[model samples]
Target: MPVSLVILAAGQGTRMNSDLPKVLHQVAAAPLLHHAMQAGLSLDPEKLVVVTGHGAEAVAKAARAYDARCDTVMQAEQLGTGHAVAQAMPLLAGMAGDCFVLYGDTPFIRPETLEAMLAARARHAVVVLGFEARDPGRYGRLIAEGEALQRIVEFKDATDEERAITLCNSGVICADTAVLADLVSAIGNSNAAGEYYLTDIVEIARKRGLSAGVVICDEAETLGVNTRAQLAEAEAAFQARARAEALDNGVTLTAPETVFFALDTHVGRDAIIGPNVIFGPGVTIESGAEILAFCHLTGCHVSRGATVGPFARLRPGAELAEDVHVGNFVEIKNAILDEGVKVGHLTYLGDADVGEHTNIGAGTVTCNYDGVNKHRTKIGKRAFIGSDTMLVAPVTVGDGAMTGSGSVITENVPAEAVALGRAKQVTKPGLAPKLFDMYKAAKAKRQKDQA
Candidate 1:
């Protein structure tokens, strides 16, 4: 049977206290809706429909960046979840398939949970993900009658006893498209808010005497973010999960709580990560690579046995080959440092390429950006860059080239040559005593005049 995924992103999420759409808020360096889209795409669904409302243009545009082929539906009015899904009804226009309805604000919803719910499929029935929480709140309470879901009763619509049920509704449901279409049709805006909640479908299913089952998962997996505090909580949860996975893969994190990893970051076995390091997505560190504290690395590759700083920043396009050493206060962006290269202390290497066995001294900078466009600097094998030297871009230091301390090199140096570009020293032989006497006389005369 064909399966489709619909993500509802219709609400303004006013509680988040920001103008940006709730789905656009980032978690783990990716927007929340991107996470939802990634999970949906992993399902290999026949069709993926995104329902946008409040920030329709922005959200639709962002979604297109990720998957241009995805179909978008707009809810002109902010009614409720049922109305949001109703917007997507046209995408399912002629196709009869099972559709998994998801929320854009719930970025942490796992693909496995969706797959499990899909696997636990029963034709002609509703399957909603559920969790047993301490407080059900405004969420619909999942009341089950011994393995069978009795009904999802909301707080206002639930009895005192039913309201007290610990299992809370996750608002994620999988249903036969035709059955879901029928369920949406029967739902009326008769509730307290007068808004059509899709949660009403479970009760409607029960009233129709149909089988509605609950797919019980850990409550954390379904904790939707509606505010900044909840968003922070969700971020913490994602970080914790990523750290645990890293440790399980033989990577050791000292003070794991202080480290953050993007969802797609790949770390090899035995890589040690210290506190306060942020690994953005597309970062991959090979085995024996050690990344110390206070490092923010994104879109970089750290090869085997390499050591990155206790305070290094490796920006996008940085590649540190095996045994490379990048020390504190070094920022490398769009640069490649070959094996045995040591870039230590107070250096910025942007749009540069350094060959193997090179030593990039402290306070050295590749003047890569010229205010308008960027240029590249190349350092050959065994080249020694002296401290406090600036190698203007479009320049190259050949193999075994030695740059004198404090020299500014604008032109390329030939292989095995020493490039020392500095003003020649001119010294005067001792006129020091005569100059000192004149200064003493002048000082005395000035003092006498003042008196």
Candidate 2:
């Protein structure tokens, strides 16, 4: 059956004590909404809707940024979960297939868990995701007989026997689109909290003789972020899982705990990541590439056999081809280094392209920006850039060209040519001794006069 996703992101998360929407807060260098959307995307749902309320604009922007096809609807009021899901009904009007309700603050729901919920739909009309919480702790209780769920009772409304049930509702549910709409519309806010509870759907479904089922998942998979401490815990959990997955996929981490990965970071098998290496979004390290300790990389690609710094930064648009060596203290931004290019210590290459086999000496810089605008520097194959050479922007060094150390290259150099743009040296004999004696005598005279 076709599937649709309705993600709830309208919670103000007042417990978080921040102006930023709870869904916009990041774990693993990505917004929590992204993680939720990523899990939903795995289902390839035909329609995706995000119900927004608190900080709706910001939440909508983040949702669209992660998936442009995502549709966002505003709840307008801080109603209950049932009201939140009701807001998405208009978007799903006449849409066939099942609708899976997800929570934005819950980022750890596994794709497999959702698949299990879908499998349960074959036997029941309503399926609710549940977990055996280590401590039920005020969570809604799922009254069930084996896999057959009878009803859900909020901790506040639950009787002593119901409260004793260890099975807790995760607030995630799956049902046919039309059935969900009807049940949500029939819901009333006459409970203890006077709020429409999505959990009521289970009892209502059972009243109509439609089967209600429960799909149990790990307790960790239902971890929800509500405050700063929980956010920190979520980050730690994400990192632990990412590290374990990398190890299982044949990537080598010299210090696994010291390495952090972003949501979209991809390191191929055989890639070696050293300690304290932080990866930001949009990074890909091909197989056999080595990223040394203390390196920060974002929006870059490192091809096979490339080795990056023990203390280097690769900014957005940086691309290192096969066998490229970018050594310590080097920073590359918006540049591409072809195969066999060596850019050793203390260099900054930005908005430039270096051809194959080029040797960039220490302290070399591509002066790409001129206060107002940015320009590009192009260095051809086999070119030699001497130490301390500054290639001013809008310049090119042809193939096999060599520049003298301390050169300020503002113009192009032809192939096979040696360019030297420095002031000629002129020496004056005995000038240093004479100047020193004059200065010392003057100093003595001044001291005597002062005395």
Candidate 3:
């Protein structure tokens, strides 16, 4: 059967203590709602509806960025979970498929677990995700008989015996679209919290003589982020899982705990990453690549056998071909370093293209941006850019050409030619002492006058 997802992102999350919406806060360099959408999208659902409340505009914008097909509805009031789900019914109307309700703050739900929940629908009319909480403290209890769930009792309302049950509701549920619509409409807010509870659907289904079951998952999968500390904890948990997966896939991390990865970081087998390397949004390392410590990379691609530095920054659009070497303190932006290209320390190569076997010496900078416009600097194969050389944009160095050290190149150099753009040296022998005498006398006269 086809499936649709209704994500509840209506909570204000006042505990987060930030101007940004809680779901919009980043974990692993992505919003929490985006993470939830990723898990639900794996099922290839027919429709996706995100219910937004606080900071709805920003939250909706982020949702569309991840899945352009995602539709959004607004929950003007924070009436509770059932009211949040009800706002999505108009969008899902006439859609004949199973609907899965998920929480935006809970992002670690695995695709396999969701698949199992859908499978459970074959035997039960409603399926709620349940977890065996180690400390069932204040969570809602899932009351069940055998494999069939009888009802869900909130901790405030549950009796002492019921509260002792370790099984808790995760607030994720799967049910037929038509059945869920009916159940949500029949719900009333008369409990201790005086809010419409999504869990009440279980009892409503039971009263109608329909069966409700549950799919069990690890407690970690239901972790909800509500504060800065909890967000950090979630990030740590995600990194642990990412590092373990990377190790199992044959990637080596010199110091795994010190390294942080973005949600979309991809490293091929045999890639080695050193300590304190932070990968931002779009990074890919091909097999045999080595990234040294303290390197930060984002939106860049490193090909086979490439070596990036101990203090390198590869910004968006930077591409390193096979056997390329980018050394310490070098920043590359919107540039391509071809195979066998060598860019050493203290260089900035932005909006430029270097051909195969080219050597970019220390302090070499491609002056790509003028006061008004940005341009490209092109260097051909085997060209040598000497130390402290500045290649002003709209300039090109032909194949096998060389530029003198400290040269400021403004025009093209022909193939196999040497370009020296510095002024001729002139020396006055034995003049150092006279110059020092003059300076000393001026300093003494100025001091005497002041006194």
Indicate which candidate wins on TM-score.
2
Write the candidate numbers in order of decreasing lDDT.
2, 3, 1
lDDT of 1 by residue, 209-321 (tens): 87888888998888788999999998998898988888999999999999998867899999999999998878999999999999999999999999999899999999999
> Candidate 3: lDDT over CA atoms?
0.95
Model 2 lDDT per residue over 4-87, tens place: 999999999999999999999999999999999999999999999999998999999999999999999999987799999999
Can you rank all candidates by TM-score, best first? 2, 3, 1
Clashing pairs in 2: none
Q: What is candidate 3's CA lDDT for residue 199?
A: 96
lDDT by residue for model 3 (1-451), tens: 7899999998889999988988998888989998899999999999999999999999999999999999999999998899999999989999897999999999899999999999999999999999999999899999998679999999988999999999999999999998999999998999999999999999999999999999999999999999999999999999998999999999999999999999889999999999999999999999999999999999999999999998999999999999999999999999999999999899999999999999999999999989999999999999999999999998999999999999999999998899988888999999999999999999999999999
CA shift at 392, candidate 1, in angstroms?
Answer: 1.1
Backbone-clash count (model 3)? 0
Error of 1 at 184 (Å): 2.5
Once fitted onto the true fold, the runs of candidate 2 whose alpha carbons sit more than 4 angstroms away are: 433-451
Report per-prediction Cα RMSD to one decimal: 3.1, 1.8, 1.7
